[model samples]
Target: MTELDSTAFELLGSTGPFAELVSGFNVREPQLRMAAAVEQAIDAREQLVVEAGTGTGKTYAYLVPVLHSGKRAILSTGTRHLQDQLFHSDLPRVCEALGVQPKLALLKGRSNYLCLHRLQLTLEEGRFARRRQAAEVQAINDWSGRTRTGDVSELSDVPEDAPVWPRVTSTADNCLGSDCPSYRDCFVLKARRRAQEAEVVVVNHHLLSADMALKEEGFGELLPGAEVVVIDEAHQLPETAAQFFGLSLGSRQLQQLARDAKAEHLREAGDMQNLPDSADALDKAAADLRLAFGQGNRRLPWKDIRHKPEVESALADLRSVLEQLRTWLETAAPRGKGLEGCWHRAEQLAHKLARVCAEADGEYVQWLETYTRSFAIHLTPLNVAGIFQQQLARLPATWVFTSATLAVGQDFHHFTGQLGLHEPHTLQLESPFDFQSNSLLYVPPALPEPNSPSYTGAVMDHAEHLIEASGGRAFLLFTSHRALQAAADRLQESEYPVLVQGQMPKRELLRRFRELGNAVLLGTSSFWEGVDVRGEALSLVLIDKLPFAAPGDPVVQARIDRLREAGGNPFMEFQVPGAVITLKQGVGRLIRDAADRGVLVLCDPRLLNKPYGRVFRRSLPPMPLTRELREVEAFFAAGMTDKGEQARA
Candidate 1:
């Protein structure tokens, strides 16, 4: 390599496209330090952990170095939205200004693409004809002809929650891979091939997890081996890794098998007498479980049923029925091709059910839940750290994880320990924005305790007060659906327009919220992070609680027990750190740009009552603090006037 290529970053020296990008853009010291550190790390080929604060421009800090290095790299973001932004907006703009010619590809998982073969089968066999209307099929038919990417996102007219997509889509279990007749025109395979040759590939955490799991199964490589992998939103890694590692068998899987069997039986016009009998038995068991769960209104751990005869009886009956169905399917397997396929699917599902029945090992926790109208049995690992460590030990790539909230109070112990990454070179970069002048932390006084009977009402009142103070540009975040609904219902009674979570599709809601520029949105998980609303449009954020995982949650309980076994205090080790990281994400939503002004109202009084409150408080952005409610109103009022004057000028 030439000298220019060897030290191009140094020779370019602080005044190229990157510097120009920040010329009138107000380059803060912390962002520049992060950019330089990223450059050094790229040259050294070492692992690094960076906690880039809100408004740190961390995207550019790493992108500049990655682009300059001119090596094949993979950028894995936490969400599909960020993956889209990086591939379509950030990379193109930066590469154009720097005159870098690096091919890039946006690669999603198999499910995200349209499977033409599956689409043809669904239409030809009339499998989903009953669930979908004629107009919907016509819309999809029109879409299939014009789509190059085959991403469902292209069909903006179709709601994401629509049922039509699932019927025509393919899952890993059913995908025939290269055996399919349309392999030459397969969208997913084509995308993977392009990604293999591209210099930079943008993918989400789920896709990365898929690749990791696939590698373990001795499958062909799903992703190219890159010299470096940059992971954004690193805080979500532990929870997502746990999901990909654990196992679960839902009622939907059983229902899908039955439906598939019916479809096949109809297609071949074969006798499905025994198959329907097994399907009916499975359906009846599912209904009985649902009814029993409804009548009990109890959330019991797997072990708690030892004393309750009724609970034990119900579980025993369910298991017996499932085993009987499995036996019937096995007997019918040798009769015909249609029967064999159904039997195979049933057997695969039954293995998981049998594991649930056996309560296989202490590493797994068994629990039953009834939500909306359906019930499910979940078997989540007590600890994913052991599995994650094993997986990482098997890999040889240089992994670079970056997020705005990985480190808590300038320490990496909270995040790095959970992911089982020890002694990695850690870096903390503060937000580029001047938080002292641009942001205010509001902790309202005279509010009811979080556990008090009237807590939700008090929180709604405080939320209303804060939103009114900020002229209705606010996000009221809650830790529970009950709290979200309470806030939304109360807000709707008032003057401000309320954009609740399910009122509309997320994309359309966000778009309308931004367009309205002065609406209050009430949401839970999805709204806690990855939301960017800059300037005066979003001037307040009200968090209903500390965002601790619910106590009844099986996964949370399992993780807590695991922490205790390690001689660590579960409250301090698991709960406190998790809340702190999530609180950071919620508050981070307020101030997106340097010039933005907002008030972050944390309604939880436990933040002040408990000793661990200090940990949560100190992890927040370094905004000017205020306990007096009037101070918040005055600050936002003045901010509004100043913004108005600037707009007029």
Candidate 2:
């Protein structure tokens, strides 16, 4: 091996810095292999995709290589939370262990940093939806006086989801750029400067995609000199890329514009009631459009409802008022920076609304999603391969995309194809944990087809048995909210503590579950991935069915139609591969640590009955598979016995 390769192996070896400095460290062959692959890719300036399974320590694998290379690198994670953790927690430890002080910076989107201009506007207005919001604003004002970073995350007094955040934080659409009165003290610009100067930069996928979008989010700054780009949790990029590449106009944006217009009107031209009047008119039109959407949250093709009289009328009225608002803002644009920003936002939103409201061009799926009080129209591209590939071509960085769940059945075709990656080197590393001994995959016998009317009841029956076997430390994952709610209601009277999703925010639910120790969490999509609960706190995962993308969803349907037009099997080529990846995520929730033992109960009959199920079966970790409830019972019984013996000893 080369000296550099030997150096990497020795660093993460059994007697390496991590093993000596970091407590509870275990060197794994998979981690070492993955790290070597990353190092080679970085040296060769190659595109590499690695599925370093859970427990493979993929984070340190790539970090050691990047730190060793001493090259400018951009490390992108899945979410802002992960980005923070890597910067504040993981990166520091690794750097300390390696005895290398790399210049690092953490950069998030503009909304994360408090905008002094918006805060000044909000303080002057003193308008709030509730009394609590006023208090939150006051708290923010107090904290703003001393925060060096001006990141809203620094203020713990106000909840992250507080309504006041939107009022204070700037978005790309509303930011006044260099014209703002607070431009000199802009936290976003300061953060970007740090990132631009740093040798190592940590960011989330949203910002990465936004950067790729280039002009859309005002990002394309820090990536110019990046010699290596490591995308941790790379599975999320395709969907995030789709969002960034798409055209969207939301109710929140329009309402925020209306509110900002009113705020700017009072500041700029109080005598001209026309601007405020148009803003109010636009609010009314937006409300009417939302009301016309009629009830439960749904996403459907815009063409499906475009012809309905109420929808058609409400949409036309909304468009008219939005255009009128843009015109009024044009007259008011010379007044102030805020008014000018509002004018630009209005013009952009109006143009986007008109384009998305128009007929599809066969390349995009024109869809509308309605919420309880708001709605959004999106024109998402059927494929993002060309756009993604073009962006990568512009960058001279070596790319590494690693995730616990990227490949399906030992191939990167499903993932690499989505991004038009050309001849990328790929690696599939099985989890280093001894899953064959520590975990069991149990598929209950005689379950009906997932579409059967009695399927949910049957699944709940199986859930009851599994939750009992694992003694309440289980996650009852369902494919739909309907099934989730049904399971929650049924478990209401059970002896075990039942924590349901949407009962509270996701973070709170997880915190409570970890605290409760034996609580059963019934959740849907969000809970399927990125959750880590080791030890006995989480010992069972019961999936109601294989998670398939909703065939009825506008984007899915559009893609299906497109594939059919091209004479491809959408089910095998698209749906099944996607489902396999998702199922891997859910299954991955169990057996997080080597010492941990758990049961994975996939309550779907399709695994055994369908021909394509082999793909999912092959893709999962090599756990002992079973079909009998007795075996599951015995697994837990053995765990209890071992604990008893350990305590006694």
User: For this target, which candidate reaches the highest lDDT against the unseen true structure?
Assistant: 2
TM-score: model 1 vs. ground truth: 0.90
Question: Residue-pair clashes per candidate, as listed?
Answer: 0, 0
Error (Å) of candidate 2 at residue 333 is 2.0
TM-score list, all predictions: 0.90, 0.98
Model 1 CA RMSD to the hidden true structure, in angstroms: 3.5
Clashing pairs in 1: none
lDDT of 1 by residue, 53-103 (tens): 887778877787788788778898998878989999989977976788898
Q: Residues 141-208, candidate 2, lDDT per residue (tens digit)?
A: 99989999998999989989888999999998999999999999999999988888899999999898
Q: Which candidate is the best by TM-score?
A: 2
lDDT of 1: 0.74
Model 2 residue 471 CA deviation (Å) reads 1.3
Candidate 1 — which residues are off by over 4 angstroms? 1-14, 19-28, 125-133, 214-224, 269-273, 280-284, 295-300, 304-341, 647-649
